[model samples]
Target: MSQPDTLGYLVPQFPGQTHIFFWREIAALEAMGVTPVLFSTRRPPAGLIAHDWSEAAMARTTYLGEVSLRRAARVLPRLPWGALLREAGRDGIAVLKDVLVCAAAGEALRDHCARQGISHVHVHSCGRAALIAAFARHLGGPGYSLTLHGPLSDYGPGQRYKWRHARFATVITRKLIAEMQAELPKDLPPMILRPMGVDTDYLRRDTPYRPVQPGEALRVFACGRLNVVKGHQDLIEAVRQLRAAGHDVTLEIAGQDDDGGGGFRLVLEQLIKQHRLQDHVRLLGAIDAASVKARLLEAHVFALASWHEPLGVAYMEAIACGVPTIGTAAGGVPELIDDGVEGLLVPPKAPEALAAALLRIAEDPALAQRLSTTGRARIERDYSARLGAEVIVSEMRKALG
Candidate 1:
């Protein structure tokens, strides 16, 4: 088959703080001679748009949430109301309202694709973005696919309705495939295991890996959203434990809370002050990708204690940068990092175990060196953003066929 000339890329909020992987994949696809028309449910909050590419990305994106009375009047008359009502009836009242709102966006999506000559769309979300695409197809728009980044429960309701009309779906982990199969119907579309990836070429370490020498201050780095489920507080406690044990440790967490910088960051700050770790811990709010890479290179260890991560691109970035990474063995993380091979793993919410893992890497230079070497190798081997883009392109072709 000939290569697709144009493809529609849908994300909930395009170019958010943690969406560097999507940007990387879009670049890879562009390099493969495919033009990706960007689509999003809405623009993210001003603070969440932290990437350097945000301006260019926003300029090219079509936001469905920018609904105007004129556009709605023009599109609503052509919607597949009967089909949408029938589907929503099977779910409940909540889904009925959701489908109604998304169906309008769907009509707008259809018109956008028609104008751009795009025949297929790939949604990087399983939430309402999936619904918008599905509704667009019902209105005789483009065929669509979905990429499930986390558990289905986290995305919201109406799972069956969302997956019913998709051409195919890509999941980030094998465990999620099993969960999807068990929850969704058997008559669903083809499911592919395509993990999220990073740009290894850019994330590569420029200098040699330097293990922390004896009695040197241990610099630990973590990157993730400031959420309770992310377990940033637990990581802070681990730093406190390391300090109490006469080990000099400094932790720099690079991320902002969902509500700009005011929400969970305050809680974490209180914890830091309560423990009197005012000087030891620093919260770096929502650094850019280059800044994150620079921090990873400067740090002796990279760690994020997510209670349940589907698969972590932050961990991938750190490992690719040759930082000895530590992650909780909660979700798809174990698939990315072997317990004792590429990096270290500990149970979630266990500050003591987290402290032990940090100490082990801090005390043993050999273990840190081994993890750093093998971890970078692991990312280079199976988790480059280019590889992920190839899988997506192949799947899109298959779906088009």
Candidate 2:
């Protein structure tokens, strides 16, 4: 009498919230009565490795190794060398590295899949995660699926064999789907627009957000890895301008400080001091999910001035919690926030624009309240995790049956 084996490929180690996604997805599928054996990688910690999810998701999960050398070789030749690097002298070498890497890792992943008799493999990102799934599926004949997000790759339409290994692909926004399709055939595998849904039970809109206490500096919260695409610099400059113009703003950043323990992090610290923002800016490195929920409750506004995003569940979660939002006009963000409705959208990399939007929200109580009320409604209606689960489950049934 042993625990039943019902799992598929899963990478519990991917960075940020994405690392937690497959586990959550498994839970959703289990709630629908389909158990999958987890093929786990190094992404998740040991304690989280063999988990019995809150909704009994483990009934459908069986952890698996994250490496396979042989399977990787099959997907290596398909790397869609970006049009920009099509002819680079080092491009071939780069492709060779990718081939070796995937062949090696994919071979291991495939072995685990075979041992479990798993019928399908689904990956959370189009980067190496999807590539590994693609390679494993190619070697073992599992119907495979991959989800795309920003930074997966700057792929052009039909550029290489990006999704060639997948039976179907899922992306979070129409905008991203369109960009990905640029490199795909006129008709790509049932590209589905599925927003990353939050655990509806954990995140809610019933929290109360109130007026800042007199002279209590406004707390502006931004989350995500401190990288160029996140536009952290733009936010810092905007906050500086706001303070210079006599606005009282307190900014708190939460994410990993990959700054040599100081890289972009040091630059951010230097900028804060240069702007004399020692009193206004604070850095909280990589807060957990519970802490993030608390911050969302206390936050005056959520700002993600990123230049690239596939679809930010962070923003959706904020609105779901009844907080208004402001983000840069880039990637799939527009597809999420209906400008002047759910949230305000500004030009990417424009500090002045961001500052103006922030100050406007700070000053307009009615507008903020209005957005908070209606924005949550939008999430409940259009972006619920229930919707994602249903769409993905339907697709999985079609593929598996």
Candidate 3:
């Protein structure tokens, strides 16, 4: 296990905000003299490669849609057809479709890795990409590993098979490790905790922890997709409650509509109007990384009442920038921020609890400042992009061995 020379990095999207953690990890790996080849299942939206870092990544990245069938055919003859067919058949039509696409992608990836001399593949999600990575490994290309970001419910039955086949796997929280261990077979690969994080330096604010002045409206900031799991609707309802209670509060939500075909955004918009929070809540759709940091700096409180967040990097960014953050005690959030230590944790999908938490922070500046100071220190002490990268690279070495 003398260090792996070349590794393949597989992701669903290449340069989107959701993949920012992967960008940081790739940068860290490059700093340590490892070669990484980026592979995306599809091309990102127009102009996503806006920043210098993303632009640079676009050069080394390969969009799997551009994969040629002629090249993929090289590995098809070597594939274990019986096992592959059985695996595909066990799943329904939906999974069979994924398997067909994944098998083709695997064949293409195998051919690409052979030419590049890549010995390992690391997929970012436990979804289709991981399935493709497992398929590629089964095609006798290279060792593979996976990182689980979303809830396990999102993954299909094939996920268990992928976990068993991966060389090693890492979940963003220890709770996920326990869940997977209990559900998966004993022969599954080693599962470890490697939490998602932010580059604190990138999110550094010139004036961290800005106290709200008298008569100034409190800037309540929340960032994430305008979808259900993020609980944006719940946050909006809480803000509505806060406004009703005679608190001068305005919430700025910064994220795109991740739901297909603008459905969820419409729902959120209707909720805002129904609650008459049109003036109180501003939907700033899809702000960049710089804008996110800027909003965090100008805010008195950062909150995301997500129902099931695996490990929110937005909370890390806000906490790193000294914003008194609040998150739901759902899915690895408590692992990142304590109830009263680093930040406040409220029950998920409870608009009343969310409003209470926001009200508490707004009324008590001392509590807000205390949480801000402690949260910043926690980010500095426990979370960093470099630290996460080092852990992942070390695990890759173990897998290589």
Candidate 4:
């Protein structure tokens, strides 16, 4: 069959590990004869884009933020003056800066896509990039759509505005869809349920699951940005308490501090010292994908006590590697992990509950084995990247018709 028409992707950053799901989805779509052209708002740091898999992608991505606006007069006639003024009135002075900047960049992006014959645009988040797509569409550009993910607090002034104008919107989980419906009851846009996916083949572990023995130390691994929302502090406290209770457990956390400065790292260090858990908890800084897989292979249990998350991919990765996963009953996580079937679910910020779940896995070998087997099977059956890309393509086809 001939290749499908190319689709433009408006994203905050291109080729960053944080958005690995997008990369996997694009790869799957390419295999099915769909081309994805990336348009990023900002170029990420060199260190973040250093992965071998992202080298070619970085070269192809266009960073609109870095483009100088010398031809502003040339694209002035394409501006949607009525839509711009109405949006300005709705948000007051608060959105004026974003509106002006993103609108200009949107025009440039629109012209670029027009030259490349791209007729449809998809934005990954409801941030400035989504606003840019909406602005472009209002200026007689291509029809656009949005793929929504969230912490629920990041939806600002133009969120509802973008949703209302897009061709259709997609959310990664049902929980997020419900939240969006409740927020925008009046002009709620059409929504589709499309969950992110993982590559089961790349994440599959060859070594079989080994249960913890009486005298061996139980290895626990967790990975994500070490920010307050991730609830790494709560995980540390749980491990400290577990060690105090005479359980042979060691927790290894792999992530970089993301609190602007080094303040968050200091707080975690203080907690470790106060509990005298110097030997029990190891702070392994941010690691690559290979390192993450290696750590998961050695771990008996994987846990991330996030107080708020929009369907964490780390949990899915661990589960695919045959490790018994533990996650809080936060946003969209319960959808990926059934309470006791795929993995254990605990309440956020509750060290006692987290400790209880860890102990349950440590004490029951059969339970751990069952979770591992079922979790991997779930990924193979429903969470492949191709499945998600196929659903998105189906929606795109309908929108075109």
Candidate 5:
């Protein structure tokens, strides 16, 4: 089958601070001669929209959270009551409530897709947005696909119902695929292993990466949301250990807390104060892609000690920019970085181990050069945004056929 002229791209809380990969994927789809109609459950919080493209993205997106009562009433009779009841029986009351809400949004989505001539949608979330797409399918709106970005548990209830109706699903890691196979039904939709990727072309460094000299401060860059599960506190402890060991090091973390920098940022600040890392560690507070790339280029090493990351695009961006990265050996990180080859991997929440890894990279220029060269090469070869886009389009073609 030939490619459709338009495709629907659905994301929950679209254009959030950590949604750069979705933006890159949309651009990739456009480059392949496919127009992506952006759909979101709702707009993200104003402060959490940090990217320069947030305004333009918001201007173009169609939000489905605002359900018209007239439309809901019109489509109410069309809902598959039998199937919904079965879903409730399998999942319970809470999921049924969410499904009902998404059913309303599905009615609106059907109307919008009819007006825009969108035949297929790819949901980038397995959360409520996936439920919206599923109900849209039930309403005869569009054939929908799903991308499982993390563990199914993190996406919330009704896992079986969400996967039952998808044309196909793309999981970020083989580990996640295994978990899905174990938890979900055997008669499930086709599952593809397509890890999230960064735009290597855009994330590449123009200038040469400079290693930390003997006297200069070892600039370390970490990027992720300021949450406890993200292990920012552990990274801070590592920075303190590196300083205590008499290595000149400075760390800059480029992300904000969920509460628009008020919630977990205060907690991280208190920890930094306890360690007396006020001068050595700075929270950059949710920087833009250009700023992150700039910092990656300037830093000697990049590190993020996530407690359990699905797959880290920040690590990809850093590696794509030729900065030797250090990620904890948790979740799908080992799939991205080899232990001692492309980048370093330390145990999660082990501040001493993280400190040792950082010190090794700072002390050894040869190891840093090898990791920098090989890490960028790895991204260019297997983890480019273009490659992921191609796989998605290919899968969409097969499904539509």
Candidate 6:
């Protein structure tokens, strides 16, 4: 029987504001009378235990060592056949490194569980946590499972690799589940029926703010990492077009670039200068979650032009805050927003369509109000954190059944 009192929740790190999914879900599981033991590379918060693996920074952000290790694993299969064997032989050494990582991680977790009288382990992402969980289980640790989010878990061979590990899988959308299921055998365990959730408590704010005026500055807000797939470029251009047409629209982009990533930030900067949008745009990097929420609370409308949104929590939060959304119809967006309801969906990479939706929302107050009321209620009914946690615990129950 699975242990009900203590659940070890694993994350590669514990500091990302975007991935509060992992941390907040832990909070959810904890409220279910299950102790959540969070395993991370960074030192845990007070009264919470953490294990450190290695310190590597991307964009000055310290992440776990497993990230680089996973990248090296990807490179190993591409070497010359002779070199491949050499690496394969050294794979034992690599395994030894993993052994150390898992030993530290598992001991921290297992010891915490033993003292607290805990039983099961659950990892938030399938990448490093999958390996750690498998290793921990091999070490005779707690029965474990993993929850998968982000493209790293779904894109390319990593998904296939991670598939070999998780006991019971959880994804945020139907598309992600289908993609994973199609890639694997039929007899694999059923994917959990849980999606990303919104903490209605934060979004349940009764604060009302006035929107941007058409004759005045039409302030547009966009948030997310400045990456290609996020479609921030398209958003900037759309804002430029509106401004060029005598609409004084100012675009405020609040996020960090992927830091040595695709140099998408340079591309965006060039686009902004070429369009002469010096006054029309503001780029704010990496604000705290409460600030993001505050921004949402004060904004006229919220928009995310991502080309790969598989159930973005941002939309749920914006909708819950009564900020109508204009999102790309890519990925799980269509599943979340109903046209003329909670929000509107536009085709990805299409500035004109996004601009049209923006214009509609900006012009019609009655439509926006109806959407806010209905959307907020939808959050309360369907996407509450408590509801999401209950769903997770139920998934565990079914697996144990």
Report lDDT (CA) for all predictions.
0.89, 0.67, 0.80, 0.81, 0.88, 0.64
lDDT top scorer: 1
Query: How well does each candidate superpose onto the true structure, as a TM-score?
Result: 0.96, 0.83, 0.92, 0.92, 0.97, 0.79
Question: How would you encode candidate 6's per-residue C-alpha lDDT over 1-401 as one tens digit per residue?
Answer: 54566566666656453655555666677777876655665532221111121122122222233344454454334323353234346443553344444434444454555665555666777655566555445445566676766554342222333355456777777777777666566424557757778778866667654555557665567778778888888888788777667666777776666452335667888888888887778766656566677778777778889988877887887888887778888887777887777788889999988877777777877777777778888777777767767766777666556
What TM-score does model 3 achieve against the real structure?
0.92
Candidate no. 1 TM-score: 0.96
In model 5, the clashing pairs are none
- lDDT, candidate 4, equals 0.81
For TM-score, candidate 5 versus 6, the one ahead is: 5
* Deviating ranges (above 4 Å) for candidate 1: 1-3, 69-91
Write the residue-wise lDDT of candidate 3 on 1-401 in tens digits: 22365778888878775567788888788887888788978767753343346777777788775766675565456666665566567665566667656767887777788878888888888888887777777877787888888677687656656777888877888888888777665647887788887887787767657667778888899988777989999999888888888888899998876543266878888999999888889887766677787788889999999999988998998899999999999988999999998899999989999999988887788998899889988998788888877777788887777
Clash pairs detected, candidate 1:
none
For model 6, what is the error of residue 152's alpha carbon versus the real structure, in angstroms, after optimal superposition?
Answer: 7.5
- The residue-by-residue lDDT of candidate 4 on 318-364, one tens digit each, is 99999999999998899999988899999999999999999999999
lDDT of 2 by residue, 1-401 (tens): 01122436455343233334455565677787766565544443332222224224334333433444454555566444453144234335554444455554565666666666666767665555555565566556466776666643553122244366566777787777766667455536777878777665667746466745557677788877767788888988999999999888988887654432366777788888888888888867666666777888898898989888767877887888888889877888888898989999999989999999998888887888888888888888887676666676677667765
Clashes of each: 0, 37, 0, 0, 0, 0
* Candidate 4 ranges beyond 4 A from true positions: 1-3, 46-50, 69-78, 81-92, 259-263
**lDDT: worst 10-residue window of model 5:** 1-10
Higher-lDDT candidate of 1 and 5: 1
Tens digits of per-residue lDDT, candidate 5, 1-401, equal: 22376888888988999999989988998999988999999998876888999999999999999887677667768877787777678878878678667778997787788888888888998989988888888888888899998888798777777788888988889999999888885647999998999898899878877788988999999999999989999999998988887888999999998889889999999999999999999999978888888888899989999999998999999999999999999999999999888799999989999999999998899999999999999999888887777877888888777
Per-residue accuracy of model 1 over 1-401 as CA lDDT, tens digit each: 23266899999988799999999999999998888899999998998888889999999999997776576566666766675566567666667667656767888898899888889999999899998998788788899999999999888766776788888888899999999888775647899888998998899988888989887999999999999999999999999998998999999999999899989999999999999999999999988888998899999999999999999999999999999999999999999999889999999999999999999998889999999999999899989898877877888887777
